[model samples]
Target: MSTNNIGPKRLVVGAHYGLKEWIIQRITAVVMVVFTIVLLVAYLISGGASYEAWAGLFSNQLMKLLTFLTFLSLFYHAWIGIRDIWMDYIKPVGIRLTLQTLTVLWLVACAAYAAEILWKV
Candidate 1:
């Protein structure tokens, strides 16, 4: 039998999100954790859980900026995780793309709303 029937060999490479997403997930998680710790420490030191106390914690511009950054990290982390799920499970390209777009829009809207609220406070 002749061995020339097969076409040229092709190499298939996936989108390779392992390391990048892993690192990002960890970094975002750490950011959230650190924020939580900071918030906790402030709350503990203040010894008051009233609305006034909460208001005081966020009165500082630096704390507001840090809060915004933590939220940004949170949204991005969620996006990466959701994108991976769509890439892995959703078979149809069109549906996956549509869902991904919707997800992004939703996240962006939420982020914008968050920013507005953060500033308003």
Candidate 2:
């Protein structure tokens, strides 16, 4: 019995990447929680019974900043999840690469558009 004849050795070692991913996910989760709470509170305060009221809430500088941050974090988290899925299940190298590239481009475009709109607020 020999190691070489058994199989290729695992290249990944230590917990650095896993730990980083976990930390990022948790931090984004917290941001989402806070953003949701604040958004709900603002909506409740505004009553949301009229379009004007909702518009007024969104027009605030603080609200715009929070909205931008929330979207950014959400986009990043989604990108990470999609990348992980592609790496885990996609067997074909060319197909996986294409999917990953498209995913990244789509996410980036959406994030940029969201940021631009937020900036106008």
Candidate 3:
């Protein structure tokens, strides 16, 4: 008797992140673009190129919140892209995990620094 390995009988593999990760990447990109536009507008309207004017722009509480949110989105976006790269190209499980761990640590540190800078503004 012949057997077929298709459809429900076929084994499914891979990261299974096609739709979800694609959506997240797009969303993060949009968030970053919006933040950039907002920052650009604010900078243009600030009407000065001095250090004090730049500081004053970030000094707003609303801007600070938006900045932090953008940073978070950026970090998350980086994480997803890097994680996918490691998963796809790194064959060794141990090395892939190590790289992923380091990526997480670096992104987290950046996020912390971002928060500190934003709050200090």
Candidate 4:
């Protein structure tokens, strides 16, 4: 008995997250860019030249929601990119998992802090 390891009989193995992650990264980036544009327009329209003016700009419920969502998108974007880096560069499974875990924890903390500060405005 024999086995073939070339041509169409070749077996390929990998932890591939090819298309889905690519699409997610693109969507998240677009969301962040659109949010930035919206924020800039809002600021410009409001003439946010003072502390009170800045506060007033963010005081609206819609603005607060959009800000929170943008923060979440930013965090998720960072997480995906960092996770991919760890997965690609760190060959050891334990180290990669540990780094991914730490990344998740840090991003979650940042998102929570962002929410708190955003709502306070």
Model 1: CA > 4 A from native: 1-16
Compare the candidates by TM-score and give the number of the best one. Answer: 3
Task: Write down the lDDT that model 1 would get.
Answer: 0.92
Which segments of model 4 are wrong by more than 4 Å? 1-16
Models 1 onward score TM values of 0.86, 0.82, 0.88, 0.86
Q: What is the model-wide C-alpha lDDT for candidate 4?
A: 0.87
Writing each residue's lDDT as its tens digit, candidate 1 over 1-121 gives 5555345644445647488889999999999999999999999999989999988888889999999999999999999999999999999999999999999999999999988988887
Ranking by lDDT: 1, 3, 4, 2
Which stretches of candidate 2 lie above 4 Å from their native place? 1-14
Best by lDDT: 1
- What local lDDT does model 1 show for residue 22? 92
Clashing pairs in 4: none
Worst 10 residues of 3 by lDDT: 8-17
In model 4, the Cα lDDT at residue 78 comes to: 89
RMSD of each: 4.0, 3.8, 2.1, 2.1
lDDT of 3 at 3: 62
Window of ten residues with lowest summed lDDT in model 2: 2-11
Candidate 3 lDDT by residue in tens digits, 30-82: 99999999978877898768899889888889889998999999999999999
**2 or 4: which has the higher lDDT?**
4
